[model samples]
Target: MSINQSTIKKLYGLSAGRCNICKRVLIEEDVQIGEMAHVIAKNPGGPRGADNLANDNRYENLILLCSIDHTIVDSKPNDYPVSRLHQIKNDHEAYVFNRLSNNRGYFEDLLALNTLFKYIPILELRGMAMELPSRISNRFEAKDMFDNFIRGNPHLYPFKDRQLDRKWCSVISNMEILDCWILGSINGLNLITISDMYNSDPIPQPCYNIYVNDERGYMALNKRYLSPEQIDYVSTEVHRIVQDFIYSHTDLVHYIRNNFNEIEW
Candidate 1:
Protein backbone atom coordinates (compact mmCIF):
# COMPACT_ATOMS: atom_id res chain seq x y z
CA MET A 1 0.00 0.00 0.00
CA SER A 2 1.10 3.58 -0.73
CA ILE A 3 0.89 6.59 1.59
CA ASN A 4 -2.55 8.13 1.16
CA GLN A 5 -3.38 11.84 0.84
CA SER A 6 -4.98 12.01 4.31
CA THR A 7 -1.87 10.56 5.93
CA ILE A 8 0.34 12.97 4.01
CA LYS A 9 -1.75 15.93 5.13
CA LYS A 10 -1.60 14.83 8.75
CA LEU A 11 2.15 14.36 8.54
CA TYR A 12 2.75 17.79 7.04
CA GLY A 13 0.34 19.50 9.48
CA LEU A 14 1.82 17.76 12.55
CA SER A 15 5.34 18.71 11.45
CA ALA A 16 4.24 22.28 10.66
CA GLY A 17 5.56 21.84 7.09
CA ARG A 18 9.15 21.51 8.38
CA CYS A 19 11.71 18.73 8.19
CA ASN A 20 11.59 16.68 11.38
CA ILE A 21 15.36 16.22 11.53
CA CYS A 22 16.72 19.73 10.86
CA LYS A 23 13.53 21.72 11.52
CA ARG A 24 14.03 23.43 8.14
CA VAL A 25 10.86 24.57 6.38
CA LEU A 26 10.01 22.18 3.58
CA ILE A 27 7.81 24.48 1.52
CA GLU A 28 9.61 27.55 0.19
CA GLU A 29 8.01 30.15 -2.11
CA ASP A 30 5.18 27.62 -2.82
CA VAL A 31 7.59 24.86 -3.82
CA GLN A 32 7.63 21.62 -1.83
CA ILE A 33 11.10 20.30 -0.97
CA GLY A 34 10.09 17.82 1.68
CA GLU A 35 9.98 14.02 1.29
CA MET A 36 8.12 11.40 3.29
CA ALA A 37 10.79 9.19 4.84
CA HIS A 38 9.66 5.86 6.18
CA VAL A 39 10.78 4.76 9.63
CA ILE A 40 10.55 1.12 8.63
CA ALA A 41 11.52 0.56 5.01
CA LYS A 42 8.71 -0.19 2.56
CA ASN A 43 10.45 -3.37 1.35
CA PRO A 44 11.37 -6.15 3.73
CA GLY A 45 15.10 -6.10 2.83
CA GLY A 46 15.33 -2.32 2.73
CA PRO A 47 16.96 -0.15 5.44
CA ARG A 48 15.40 -0.66 8.91
CA GLY A 49 13.11 -3.16 7.21
CA ALA A 50 11.60 -6.15 8.95
CA ASP A 51 9.41 -8.99 7.81
CA ASN A 52 7.16 -8.42 10.81
CA LEU A 53 6.29 -4.86 9.84
CA ALA A 54 3.43 -4.67 7.34
CA ASN A 55 1.85 -1.71 5.57
CA ASP A 56 4.74 0.65 6.28
CA ASN A 57 3.05 3.52 4.49
CA ARG A 58 0.87 4.43 7.46
CA TYR A 59 1.26 7.84 9.15
CA GLU A 60 2.61 6.19 12.32
CA ASN A 61 5.54 4.80 10.30
CA LEU A 62 6.32 7.97 8.32
CA ILE A 63 8.49 11.02 9.04
CA LEU A 64 8.76 14.23 7.07
CA LEU A 65 12.27 15.38 6.07
CA CYS A 66 14.31 17.30 3.56
CA SER A 67 15.81 15.22 0.73
CA ILE A 68 19.22 15.44 2.36
CA ASP A 69 18.04 14.15 5.73
CA HIS A 70 16.00 11.41 4.07
CA THR A 71 19.08 10.11 2.26
CA ILE A 72 21.23 10.29 5.40
CA VAL A 73 18.72 8.48 7.62
CA ASP A 74 18.14 5.67 5.10
CA SER A 75 21.87 5.30 4.40
CA LYS A 76 22.79 4.99 8.09
CA PRO A 77 19.90 3.01 9.51
CA ASN A 78 22.06 1.70 12.35
CA ASP A 79 22.76 5.25 13.56
CA TYR A 80 19.06 6.20 13.52
CA PRO A 81 17.19 3.33 15.10
CA VAL A 82 13.44 2.84 15.18
CA SER A 83 13.19 3.95 18.82
CA ARG A 84 15.17 7.14 18.20
CA LEU A 85 13.06 7.99 15.17
CA HIS A 86 9.82 7.49 17.08
CA GLN A 87 11.07 9.78 19.86
CA ILE A 88 12.04 12.46 17.37
CA LYS A 89 8.65 12.33 15.68
CA ASN A 90 6.80 12.54 18.99
CA ASP A 91 8.89 15.46 20.20
CA HIS A 92 8.50 17.37 16.92
CA GLU A 93 4.71 16.87 16.79
CA ALA A 94 4.38 17.99 20.42
CA TYR A 95 6.47 21.07 19.68
CA VAL A 96 4.27 22.03 16.73
CA PHE A 97 1.01 21.56 18.64
CA ASN A 98 2.15 23.49 21.73
CA ARG A 99 4.01 26.30 19.97
CA LEU A 100 2.35 26.62 16.57
CA SER A 101 -1.26 25.48 16.97
CA ASN A 102 -3.96 28.11 17.66
CA ASN A 103 -5.31 26.30 20.72
CA ARG A 104 -1.91 26.01 22.36
CA GLY A 105 -1.22 25.60 26.08
CA TYR A 106 1.30 28.44 26.36
CA PHE A 107 -1.39 30.91 27.41
CA GLU A 108 -2.60 28.71 30.26
CA ASP A 109 0.43 29.61 32.36
CA LEU A 110 -0.28 33.32 31.86
CA LEU A 111 -3.75 32.97 33.39
CA ALA A 112 -2.29 33.11 36.88
CA LEU A 113 -0.51 36.40 36.23
CA ASN A 114 -2.25 39.41 37.79
CA THR A 115 -1.52 41.47 34.67
CA LEU A 116 -3.78 39.25 32.53
CA PHE A 117 -6.87 40.52 34.33
CA LYS A 118 -6.32 44.04 33.05
CA TYR A 119 -7.08 43.10 29.44
CA ILE A 120 -9.85 40.56 30.11
CA PRO A 121 -12.55 43.23 30.57
CA ILE A 122 -11.85 44.83 27.21
CA LEU A 123 -12.15 41.53 25.39
CA GLU A 124 -15.29 40.63 27.35
CA LEU A 125 -16.87 44.02 26.75
CA ARG A 126 -16.15 43.81 23.06
CA GLY A 127 -17.81 40.40 22.89
CA MET A 128 -20.88 41.48 24.89
CA ALA A 129 -21.27 44.65 22.83
CA MET A 130 -21.41 42.68 19.59
CA GLU A 131 -24.07 40.27 20.87
CA LEU A 132 -26.77 42.83 21.69
CA PRO A 133 -28.22 45.52 19.40
CA SER A 134 -28.84 47.78 22.40
CA ARG A 135 -25.09 47.59 23.12
CA ILE A 136 -24.11 49.01 19.70
CA SER A 137 -22.78 52.16 21.36
CA ASN A 138 -20.68 50.02 23.64
CA ARG A 139 -19.17 48.38 20.58
CA PHE A 140 -17.80 51.71 19.32
CA GLU A 141 -16.49 52.56 22.78
CA ALA A 142 -14.77 49.22 23.09
CA LYS A 143 -13.19 49.60 19.66
CA ASP A 144 -11.78 53.02 20.57
CA MET A 145 -10.45 51.70 23.86
CA PHE A 146 -8.85 48.72 22.15
CA ASP A 147 -7.33 50.78 19.34
CA ASN A 148 -5.96 53.32 21.80
CA PHE A 149 -4.34 50.61 23.90
CA ILE A 150 -2.62 49.07 20.90
CA ARG A 151 -1.60 52.42 19.40
CA GLY A 152 -0.35 53.93 22.66
CA ASN A 153 1.80 50.88 23.38
CA PRO A 154 4.32 50.34 20.64
CA HIS A 155 5.82 47.28 22.28
CA LEU A 156 2.58 45.30 21.84
CA TYR A 157 2.80 45.57 18.07
CA PRO A 158 4.94 42.56 17.17
CA PHE A 159 3.77 42.37 13.55
CA LYS A 160 5.22 45.82 12.86
CA ASP A 161 8.92 44.78 12.88
CA ARG A 162 9.51 41.18 11.91
CA GLN A 163 8.25 38.27 9.88
CA LEU A 164 5.49 36.35 11.68
CA ASP A 165 4.40 32.74 11.55
CA ARG A 166 1.19 31.83 9.66
CA LYS A 167 -0.73 31.55 12.95
CA TRP A 168 0.18 35.08 14.01
CA CYS A 169 -0.64 36.45 10.57
CA SER A 170 -4.11 34.91 10.82
CA VAL A 171 -4.66 36.42 14.26
CA ILE A 172 -3.67 39.89 13.08
CA SER A 173 -5.82 39.62 9.97
CA ASN A 174 -8.90 38.69 12.02
CA MET A 175 -8.18 41.63 14.34
CA GLU A 176 -8.13 43.99 11.36
CA ILE A 177 -11.53 42.66 10.22
CA LEU A 178 -12.94 43.14 13.72
CA ASP A 179 -11.66 46.70 13.77
CA CYS A 180 -13.20 47.46 10.37
CA TRP A 181 -16.59 46.07 11.40
CA ILE A 182 -16.57 48.04 14.64
CA LEU A 183 -15.90 51.21 12.60
CA GLY A 184 -19.21 50.70 10.73
CA SER A 185 -18.04 49.55 7.32
CA ILE A 186 -20.81 47.65 5.61
CA ASN A 187 -19.30 46.12 2.52
CA GLY A 188 -16.35 48.25 1.26
CA LEU A 189 -18.29 51.48 0.97
CA ASN A 190 -17.82 52.62 4.61
CA LEU A 191 -21.55 53.50 4.42
CA ILE A 192 -24.47 51.61 5.80
CA THR A 193 -27.91 51.74 4.14
CA ILE A 194 -31.33 50.86 5.52
CA SER A 195 -31.52 48.00 3.05
CA ASP A 196 -28.37 46.58 4.61
CA MET A 197 -30.34 45.96 7.79
CA TYR A 198 -33.47 44.39 6.26
CA ASN A 199 -33.95 41.81 3.57
CA SER A 200 -36.81 41.67 0.97
CA ASP A 201 -39.29 40.65 3.68
CA PRO A 202 -39.77 43.26 6.40
CA ILE A 203 -40.16 40.67 9.17
CA PRO A 204 -38.58 37.29 10.13
CA GLN A 205 -35.32 37.75 8.25
CA PRO A 206 -33.47 34.57 7.28
CA CYS A 207 -30.07 36.00 8.18
CA TYR A 208 -28.47 39.20 9.42
CA ASN A 209 -25.48 40.20 7.30
CA ILE A 210 -22.25 41.98 8.20
CA TYR A 211 -19.97 42.61 5.24
CA VAL A 212 -16.17 42.55 5.02
CA ASN A 213 -14.10 43.60 2.04
CA ASP A 214 -11.84 40.70 1.21
CA GLU A 215 -9.81 40.13 -1.97
CA ARG A 216 -12.92 38.61 -3.48
CA GLY A 217 -14.68 41.93 -2.66
CA TYR A 218 -17.40 42.50 -0.08
CA MET A 219 -18.58 39.29 1.55
CA ALA A 220 -20.70 38.47 4.54
CA LEU A 221 -18.64 38.41 7.71
CA ASN A 222 -21.52 37.25 9.87
CA LYS A 223 -24.78 35.92 8.43
CA ARG A 224 -26.84 36.10 11.60
CA TYR A 225 -27.83 39.31 13.37
CA LEU A 226 -26.80 39.50 17.02
CA SER A 227 -26.90 35.70 17.25
CA PRO A 228 -25.45 33.42 19.86
CA GLU A 229 -23.59 31.62 17.07
CA GLN A 230 -21.97 34.85 15.87
CA ILE A 231 -21.18 35.93 19.38
CA ASP A 232 -19.57 32.56 20.18
CA TYR A 233 -17.43 32.64 17.05
CA VAL A 234 -16.27 36.21 17.73
CA SER A 235 -15.59 35.47 21.38
CA THR A 236 -13.57 32.35 20.56
CA GLU A 237 -11.54 34.15 17.92
CA VAL A 238 -10.87 37.16 20.14
CA HIS A 239 -9.91 34.95 23.04
CA ARG A 240 -7.49 33.00 20.89
CA ILE A 241 -5.85 36.17 19.60
CA VAL A 242 -5.64 37.73 23.06
CA GLN A 243 -4.30 34.56 24.67
CA ASP A 244 -1.71 34.07 21.97
CA PHE A 245 -0.70 37.71 22.18
CA ILE A 246 -0.23 37.48 25.91
CA TYR A 247 1.79 34.29 25.57
CA SER A 248 3.95 35.73 22.83
CA HIS A 249 4.48 39.10 24.52
CA THR A 250 4.28 38.48 28.25
CA ASP A 251 6.58 41.36 29.11
CA LEU A 252 4.44 43.78 27.10
CA VAL A 253 1.22 42.70 28.77
CA HIS A 254 2.90 43.19 32.13
CA TYR A 255 4.00 46.65 31.00
CA ILE A 256 0.35 47.64 30.52
CA ARG A 257 -0.56 46.24 33.90
CA ASN A 258 2.30 48.04 35.63
CA ASN A 259 1.25 51.41 34.20
CA PHE A 260 -2.52 50.75 34.31
CA ASN A 261 -3.07 53.42 36.97
CA GLU A 262 -1.35 56.15 34.93
CA ILE A 263 -2.84 55.35 31.49
CA GLU A 264 -5.89 57.46 30.59
CA TRP A 265 -8.94 55.43 29.65
Candidate 2:
Protein backbone atom coordinates (compact mmCIF):
# COMPACT_ATOMS: atom_id res chain seq x y z
CA MET A 1 0.00 0.00 0.00
CA SER A 2 1.14 3.55 -0.70
CA ILE A 3 2.15 5.67 2.28
CA ASN A 4 -0.50 8.29 3.05
CA GLN A 5 0.11 11.93 3.90
CA SER A 6 -1.07 11.36 7.47
CA THR A 7 1.49 8.60 7.89
CA ILE A 8 4.21 10.87 6.47
CA LYS A 9 3.21 13.73 8.73
CA LYS A 10 3.05 11.48 11.77
CA LEU A 11 6.52 10.13 11.00
CA TYR A 12 7.86 13.65 10.58
CA GLY A 13 6.44 14.87 13.85
CA LEU A 14 7.50 11.71 15.70
CA SER A 15 10.98 12.29 14.32
CA ALA A 16 10.89 15.93 15.38
CA GLY A 17 11.61 16.78 11.72
CA ARG A 18 14.99 15.02 11.89
CA CYS A 19 16.48 11.98 10.20
CA ASN A 20 16.28 9.00 12.56
CA ILE A 21 19.64 7.50 11.63
CA CYS A 22 22.01 10.47 11.17
CA LYS A 23 19.92 12.85 13.29
CA ARG A 24 20.01 15.36 10.46
CA VAL A 25 17.43 18.10 10.95
CA LEU A 26 14.78 18.13 8.22
CA ILE A 27 13.38 21.58 7.51
CA GLU A 28 11.36 23.01 4.62
CA GLU A 29 14.59 23.76 2.77
CA ASP A 30 15.63 20.10 2.99
CA VAL A 31 12.15 18.71 2.52
CA GLN A 32 13.10 16.50 -0.40
CA ILE A 33 16.26 15.16 1.24
CA GLY A 34 15.13 12.54 3.78
CA GLU A 35 13.69 9.14 2.89
CA MET A 36 11.44 7.04 5.06
CA ALA A 37 13.14 3.68 4.58
CA HIS A 38 11.37 0.47 5.42
CA VAL A 39 12.97 -1.65 8.10
CA ILE A 40 12.11 -4.79 6.16
CA ALA A 41 12.54 -4.83 2.41
CA LYS A 42 9.37 -5.47 0.43
CA ASN A 43 11.23 -8.16 -1.56
CA PRO A 44 9.59 -11.62 -1.68
CA GLY A 45 12.40 -13.22 0.36
CA GLY A 46 12.55 -10.45 2.97
CA PRO A 47 12.09 -11.25 6.67
CA ARG A 48 8.71 -10.71 8.26
CA GLY A 49 7.11 -9.27 5.13
CA ALA A 50 3.53 -9.71 6.28
CA ASP A 51 4.11 -8.22 9.76
CA ASN A 52 6.41 -5.54 8.41
CA LEU A 53 3.89 -4.47 5.76
CA ALA A 54 1.18 -4.45 8.41
CA ASN A 55 3.17 -1.83 10.34
CA ASP A 56 5.50 -0.58 7.58
CA ASN A 57 2.96 1.35 5.53
CA ARG A 58 2.43 3.13 8.84
CA TYR A 59 4.93 4.72 11.25
CA GLU A 60 6.57 1.90 13.21
CA ASN A 61 8.12 0.15 10.21
CA LEU A 62 9.39 3.39 8.65
CA ILE A 63 12.66 5.00 9.72
CA LEU A 64 13.56 8.54 8.71
CA LEU A 65 17.04 8.62 7.20
CA CYS A 66 19.08 11.02 5.11
CA SER A 67 19.77 10.07 1.50
CA ILE A 68 23.22 8.66 2.36
CA ASP A 69 22.13 6.73 5.44
CA HIS A 70 19.04 5.51 3.63
CA THR A 71 21.15 3.89 0.91
CA ILE A 72 23.61 2.56 3.49
CA VAL A 73 20.91 0.83 5.53
CA ASP A 74 19.21 -0.56 2.47
CA SER A 75 22.51 -1.79 1.05
CA LYS A 76 23.66 -3.47 4.29
CA PRO A 77 20.28 -4.72 5.43
CA ASN A 78 21.99 -7.69 7.10
CA ASP A 79 24.25 -5.47 9.20
CA TYR A 80 21.43 -3.04 10.11
CA PRO A 81 18.95 -5.75 11.02
CA VAL A 82 15.28 -5.12 11.82
CA SER A 83 15.66 -5.46 15.59
CA ARG A 84 18.70 -3.20 15.62
CA LEU A 85 16.85 -0.68 13.47
CA HIS A 86 13.93 -0.78 15.89
CA GLN A 87 16.26 -0.10 18.82
CA ILE A 88 17.75 2.84 16.97
CA LYS A 89 14.32 4.19 16.15
CA ASN A 90 13.05 3.86 19.70
CA ASP A 91 16.13 5.48 21.23
CA HIS A 92 16.17 8.32 18.71
CA GLU A 93 12.48 9.07 19.13
CA ALA A 94 12.85 9.00 22.92
CA TYR A 95 15.78 11.41 22.73
CA VAL A 96 13.75 13.74 20.56
CA PHE A 97 10.74 13.56 22.88
CA ASN A 98 12.84 14.18 26.00
CA ARG A 99 14.72 17.12 24.48
CA LEU A 100 11.60 18.96 23.33
CA SER A 101 9.72 18.24 26.55
CA ASN A 102 12.58 19.21 28.86
CA ASN A 103 14.02 22.23 27.05
CA ARG A 104 16.86 23.86 28.97
CA GLY A 105 16.56 27.33 27.43
CA TYR A 106 15.07 28.63 30.67
CA PHE A 107 16.43 28.28 34.21
CA GLU A 108 16.42 24.70 35.52
CA ASP A 109 13.29 25.07 37.66
CA LEU A 110 11.44 26.86 34.91
CA LEU A 111 12.70 24.40 32.34
CA ALA A 112 11.27 21.51 34.35
CA LEU A 113 7.95 23.24 34.80
CA ASN A 114 7.95 24.08 31.11
CA THR A 115 8.51 20.43 30.34
CA LEU A 116 5.71 19.53 32.71
CA PHE A 117 3.38 21.92 30.90
CA LYS A 118 4.47 20.64 27.52
CA TYR A 119 3.91 16.95 28.28
CA ILE A 120 1.16 16.88 30.91
CA PRO A 121 -1.54 17.75 28.40
CA ILE A 122 -0.36 14.97 26.09
CA LEU A 123 -0.37 12.50 28.95
CA GLU A 124 -3.83 13.61 30.09
CA LEU A 125 -5.13 13.19 26.57
CA ARG A 126 -3.64 9.70 26.54
CA GLY A 127 -5.91 8.74 29.46
CA MET A 128 -3.19 8.84 32.10
CA ALA A 129 -4.63 11.05 34.81
CA MET A 130 -2.11 13.38 36.43
CA GLU A 131 -2.04 11.63 39.79
CA LEU A 132 -1.25 13.97 42.66
CA PRO A 133 -0.66 13.41 46.35
CA SER A 134 -3.54 11.95 48.44
CA ARG A 135 -5.77 14.95 49.12
CA ILE A 136 -4.13 18.28 48.52
CA SER A 137 -6.79 20.95 49.15
CA ASN A 138 -6.41 23.96 46.83
CA ARG A 139 -3.48 25.19 44.78
CA PHE A 140 -2.25 27.39 47.62
CA GLU A 141 -2.75 24.58 50.09
CA ALA A 142 -0.96 22.20 47.78
CA LYS A 143 1.96 24.60 47.40
CA ASP A 144 2.27 25.10 51.16
CA MET A 145 1.79 21.45 52.10
CA PHE A 146 3.90 20.11 49.30
CA ASP A 147 6.71 22.47 50.10
CA ASN A 148 6.75 21.33 53.70
CA PHE A 149 6.32 17.64 52.87
CA ILE A 150 9.00 17.40 50.21
CA ARG A 151 11.42 19.45 52.24
CA GLY A 152 10.80 17.81 55.59
CA ASN A 153 10.51 14.22 54.44
CA PRO A 154 12.69 13.71 51.43
CA HIS A 155 13.54 10.16 52.58
CA LEU A 156 9.92 9.11 52.46
CA TYR A 157 9.45 10.29 48.89
CA PRO A 158 12.03 8.10 47.20
CA PHE A 159 11.98 7.74 43.41
CA LYS A 160 10.63 4.19 43.88
CA ASP A 161 7.25 3.43 45.39
CA ARG A 162 5.97 0.25 47.10
CA GLN A 163 6.50 -1.87 44.01
CA LEU A 164 10.08 -0.56 43.65
CA ASP A 165 9.22 -0.29 39.94
CA ARG A 166 7.40 2.35 37.95
CA LYS A 167 9.70 5.03 39.36
CA TRP A 168 8.04 7.39 36.92
CA CYS A 169 5.17 7.75 39.39
CA SER A 170 7.27 10.19 41.40
CA VAL A 171 7.98 12.14 38.26
CA ILE A 172 4.29 12.10 37.40
CA SER A 173 3.43 13.43 40.87
CA ASN A 174 5.79 16.35 40.43
CA MET A 175 4.39 17.08 36.97
CA GLU A 176 0.89 16.92 38.42
CA ILE A 177 1.85 19.56 40.97
CA LEU A 178 3.19 21.77 38.22
CA ASP A 179 0.07 21.11 36.16
CA CYS A 180 -2.17 22.11 39.07
CA TRP A 181 -0.16 25.25 39.65
CA ILE A 182 -0.40 26.19 35.99
CA LEU A 183 -4.13 25.56 35.94
CA GLY A 184 -4.64 27.80 38.94
CA SER A 185 -2.50 30.50 37.42
CA ILE A 186 -4.21 30.31 34.04
CA ASN A 187 -7.79 30.30 35.35
CA GLY A 188 -7.15 33.05 37.93
CA LEU A 189 -8.28 30.59 40.58
CA ASN A 190 -6.80 30.78 44.07
CA LEU A 191 -7.42 27.24 45.33
CA ILE A 192 -6.65 24.40 42.89
CA THR A 193 -7.71 20.94 44.05
CA ILE A 194 -5.27 18.30 42.93
CA SER A 195 -7.39 15.16 43.54
CA ASP A 196 -10.71 15.08 45.34
CA MET A 197 -10.94 11.29 45.30
CA TYR A 198 -10.46 10.37 48.94
CA ASN A 199 -12.52 7.54 50.44
CA SER A 200 -10.33 7.87 53.50
CA ASP A 201 -7.15 9.78 54.29
CA PRO A 202 -4.63 9.00 51.55
CA ILE A 203 -1.67 10.44 53.41
CA PRO A 204 -0.54 8.51 56.48
CA GLN A 205 1.30 9.54 59.66
CA PRO A 206 4.95 10.75 60.13
CA CYS A 207 3.80 13.10 57.38
CA TYR A 208 1.75 15.76 59.12
CA ASN A 209 -1.78 16.43 57.92
CA ILE A 210 -2.49 19.98 58.98
CA TYR A 211 -6.18 20.41 58.35
CA VAL A 212 -6.58 23.95 57.18
CA ASN A 213 -10.16 23.48 55.97
CA ASP A 214 -11.91 20.10 56.17
CA GLU A 215 -15.12 21.72 54.94
CA ARG A 216 -13.37 22.99 51.80
CA GLY A 217 -12.29 19.48 50.70
CA TYR A 218 -10.34 16.38 51.72
CA MET A 219 -6.79 17.14 52.92
CA ALA A 220 -3.82 14.76 52.88
CA LEU A 221 -0.15 15.45 52.32
CA ASN A 222 3.16 13.74 51.74
CA LYS A 223 6.40 14.62 49.94
CA ARG A 224 6.91 15.02 46.18
CA TYR A 225 10.43 16.52 46.15
CA LEU A 226 10.01 20.18 45.23
CA SER A 227 10.69 23.26 47.34
CA PRO A 228 8.78 26.51 47.58
CA GLU A 229 11.80 28.32 46.17
CA GLN A 230 11.63 26.13 43.07
CA ILE A 231 7.95 26.95 42.72
CA ASP A 232 8.72 30.67 42.93
CA TYR A 233 11.44 30.32 40.31
CA VAL A 234 9.21 28.28 38.00
CA SER A 235 6.37 30.80 38.39
CA THR A 236 8.47 33.39 36.59
CA GLU A 237 9.56 30.81 34.01
CA VAL A 238 5.94 29.82 33.29
CA HIS A 239 5.14 33.43 32.57
CA ARG A 240 8.11 33.63 30.22
CA ILE A 241 7.13 30.54 28.20
CA VAL A 242 3.44 31.54 28.04
CA GLN A 243 4.32 35.10 26.97
CA ASP A 244 6.85 33.92 24.41
CA PHE A 245 4.44 31.33 22.99
CA ILE A 246 1.66 33.93 22.75
CA TYR A 247 3.88 36.53 21.09
CA SER A 248 5.38 34.09 18.62
CA HIS A 249 2.07 32.37 17.85
CA THR A 250 -0.50 35.16 17.77
CA ASP A 251 -2.76 33.03 15.61
CA LEU A 252 -2.87 30.43 18.39
CA VAL A 253 -3.92 33.16 20.80
CA HIS A 254 -6.66 34.23 18.40
CA TYR A 255 -7.83 30.65 17.97
CA ILE A 256 -7.88 30.08 21.70
CA ARG A 257 -9.75 33.31 22.40
CA ASN A 258 -12.25 32.53 19.67
CA ASN A 259 -13.17 29.19 21.19
CA PHE A 260 -12.02 29.73 24.76
CA ASN A 261 -15.22 28.45 26.36
CA GLU A 262 -16.05 25.85 23.74
CA ILE A 263 -12.82 23.98 24.53
CA GLU A 264 -13.41 20.86 26.63
CA TRP A 265 -10.97 20.72 29.50
For residues 1-265, could you state the per-residue lDDT of candidate 2 as single tens digits? 7889988998888888788878887665645677888887665365434542444576777888888888888777678988999998899989998886544322333333233333234223221212222233343232344445457555444322122213234333544445554454334322222221112233221222222234655343222433454334444544543343333234432433353333332
Whole-model lDDT per candidate: 0.58, 0.51
**Window of ten residues with lowest summed lDDT in model 1:** 105-114
Query: Per-residue lDDT tens digits of candidate 1, residues 2-62?
Result: 7899999999999999999899999989999999998999888888999989557899999
Candidate 1 has what TM-score? 0.42
Clashes of each: 0, 1
**What is the Cα-based lDDT of residue 220 in candidate 2?**
38
List where candidate 2 sits over 4 angstroms from the true fold: 28-30, 45-55, 104-265
lDDT of 2 at 142: 28
All candidates' TM-scores?
0.42, 0.39
Once fitted onto the true fold, the runs of candidate 1 whose alpha carbons sit more than 4 angstroms away are: 101-265
